[model samples]
Target: MQNTSHLLMIRPVKFSFNEQTAVNNAFQQNDTNNNVAEMAAREFDAFAQKLQANGVDVTIVEDTPEPYTPDSIFPNNWISFHEDGNIILYPMFAVNRRAERKPHVLKAIEKKFRIQNKIDLTALEANHQFLEGTGSMVLDRDHKIAYACLSPRTHMSALNNFAEKTGFTTVAFHANDRNGLPIYHTNVMMCVADQFVVVCMESITDENEKKLVRDAIHKTDKSIILISFHQMEHFAGNMLQVQNNRGEKLLIMSTQAYESLTADQIKILENYNRIIHSSLNTIETNGGGSARCMLAEVFLPVQQTQ
Candidate 1:
């Protein structure tokens, strides 16, 4: 299944500007407001409510305040829940971000979801190689293909390692922002849903690799909606498609991202699924991530009754 109704989100306790992630993530801003955390929590709550009201299953976990992990709201970077009852712990790039892997987080998830194998990739952090889970790779799960854009935060070694262990063929490429700096994470510029893919083709710089990426998605029989670099900056590329309990497909994105889309683009996307967007300006400004980053898709099987 490409889309999952179940999602895991961390309700922020210390959500604010992350200095460590700001060095590479161009999307983050420090001068957002004085009360960043409060506004972020409100936005989080609203987004979660909207998703749940639409029949999406959300498992909300409260974040610990002690660690001072300002970017913990974006949990997709550290852990991924898979369909085979496997959970993968990834090695994060920022030193402070590494503290997000608290054991209690997993324990909380285990109560509702049955996890079979625990794949720990944190050992790679010692060698300065990081993958940052799904943030580094936009996965086409139904086709068993991984689309990755390499950067300091997304190392080739870690990509190969994940491919080796998961049996997902990798389509690796390099991408840069409009300013010519490498984009920190692949999810910032691309999203692979079941029927189609949303991507910033301008960011791919290399023509050959761009063609390869297009061919890969085409081979999988998915339509492509090419987003401009300007649209990408507004997080138009960070959308995620998810199924509801009623088996309806819905495309999710931040309000900023939805407003940035062109009529044609919106029309194309609407043909595939209903679009659900929420205001996330505060979280987007401080955390440097949007709606998709806040959601870690929970693909693990539900705990059966006795």
Candidate 2:
């Protein structure tokens, strides 16, 4: 299936602006007026309901309170479920995020879907290397390509390891934030969909690297929608393509990202799929993640009804 209607979202018990992640993620802001954790819960609830109402099969799980992992809501960072019955656990840069990986979550998922193999990359974190799953690498599943940008949170060794295990060819580049610091996550600057790739090509300053990435996308027959750095900062590239229960293609994003689009951009995207966005001001302001981060698509086969 090209699009997965099933999505996994973590209902945060203690969601707050993560200071550790903020060092690299410029999108986050610390707000004192808003009760951040409570606000996040409400936003999450609404987001989940919105998705469900749109005919998406949403699985909402409450985060365990004991660990106090604030960023646990972004489960796509620590784990990814593949259509091939493969589950990948990735290495996280933040120490607290490492705790987000829970065996119990896997157990919970296994009850609903079969897992044929498990690939663990968390051990690389011990060596101070990290690759925060989908956040770090945007998978072009149809083309067997992993589009990644090098950053502190995305180590080359870990990327290579993932490519080898997943049988994906990697198109890697260096991406920087406004101040020239490495962008925290690749998904923040680019998204690879089945027929198109949304990217901030200007962020890859080196001509050779930019050409390589452009060529890779071209080879896969994907039309490129390039965004400016300012637009990327607005979370324009952080979009996910999903399917509804009726198998209708929907493009999911934050309201901010939706508004950031130019009329032409929207027209281009509408040609491929329907747009679905929610106001995630609270989530994006404090969580440093948008709609793509909030959804961890579950590609495992549906379990038989007993």
* Candidate 2 local Cα displacement, residue 218, angstroms: 0.7
Q: lDDT for each of the candidates?
A: 0.94, 0.89
Native-referenced Cα lDDT, model 2? 0.89
| Cα misplacement distance, residue 7 of candidate 1 (Å) | 0.2
Candidate 2 lDDT for residue 269: 98
TM-scores for all candidates: the values are: 0.99, 0.97
Q: For this target, which candidate reaches the highest lDDT against the unseen true structure?
A: 1
**Positional deviation of residue 39's Cα in model 2 after best superposition, in angstroms:** 1.2
Name the regions of candidate 1 deviating beyond 4 angstroms.
Answer: none
Quote the positional error of residue 59 for candidate 1 in Å: 0.2
Mark the 10 consecutive residues where model 1 has the least summed lDDT: 28-37
lDDT of 1 by residue, 196-306 (tens): 999999999999999999999999999999999999999998999999999999999999999999999999999999999999999988778999999999999999979
Error of 2 at 176 (Å): 1.0
